[model samples]
Target: MEPDVLGLVAGALTTIAFVPQVLRILRTRSAHDISWLLFGILAVGSAMWLWYGVRVNSLPLVVTNVITLTLQLSIFGLKWRYGRGKRP
Candidate 1:
């Protein structure tokens, strides 16, 4: 397999890894157990990686991280909304 092909394969796998979690959250309509700190770090880190990908003009990095960042942010949104009242 070529390098690009390998990258795509890896990207696809990592990208899809979040799918089940996202689906579960959406299906159940709950994110009560998620940690805000963890998701915040993930979103910020992924956004930085996205910026880096854009800076270096790397297609795989840009594409993979874009999806990752979006997923992380969405999870974060759910985490925030659903996690709020549970603590009290």
Candidate 2:
């Protein structure tokens, strides 16, 4: 496989890895076990990576980070909604 193809595969895998957690949280309407701080940091980091990818003109990085950012933001929203009153 070509390098771009390999990158695309890896990007897709990493990008989609957050989907299960998102779906679980949405279905359960519970984010008590999820770490809000961690997800917050991840979202920020992913955003920065996406900006960097744009600057570097890397399609795989841009695409993957955009997807990851969206998923991470969704989790953040769930965390705020369902994890606010819960204590770890």
Candidate 3:
């Protein structure tokens, strides 16, 4: 298999992995168990990955990191909105 193909597959899988969590949060309307630190780190990391992808000119990294960052930011926002007054 080609490297781009492999990267696309891997990126798709990892990006898709966040879907369930987002859906679950939406369904449950609860994010008390989510961690602010973790998602904060993830958001930063994803942003860095996105930047790296842009620098390297890798479509897979760019696309996937964009998506991953979006999802992570969504989760982070949800965590903040839903976790208000809740424990970590």
Q: Which structure among the candidates has the greatest lDDT?
A: 3
Candidate 1, residues 1-88: lDDT per residue as tens digits?
A: 8866787778889889778888888887777777778878888988998899899887888888999999988887776666655654
TM-score of each: 0.84, 0.88, 0.91
How well does model 2 score by local distance difference test? Answer: 0.87
For 1-88, candidate 2 gives per-residue lDDT tens digits of 9877887899998888799999999898888889877888988999999999999888888888989998998888888888776565
User: Which ten-residue region of model 1 has the weakest summed lDDT?
Assistant: 79-88
Model 3 residue runs over 4 Å out of place are none
lDDT of each: 0.82, 0.87, 0.91
Residue-by-residue lDDT tens digits, candidate 3, 1-88: 9999999999999899899999999999899988888888988999999999999999999999999999998998888788766664
**What shift in Å separates residue 84 of candidate 1 from its native position after superposition?**
2.0
Clashes by residue pair, model 2: none
lDDT of 1: 0.82
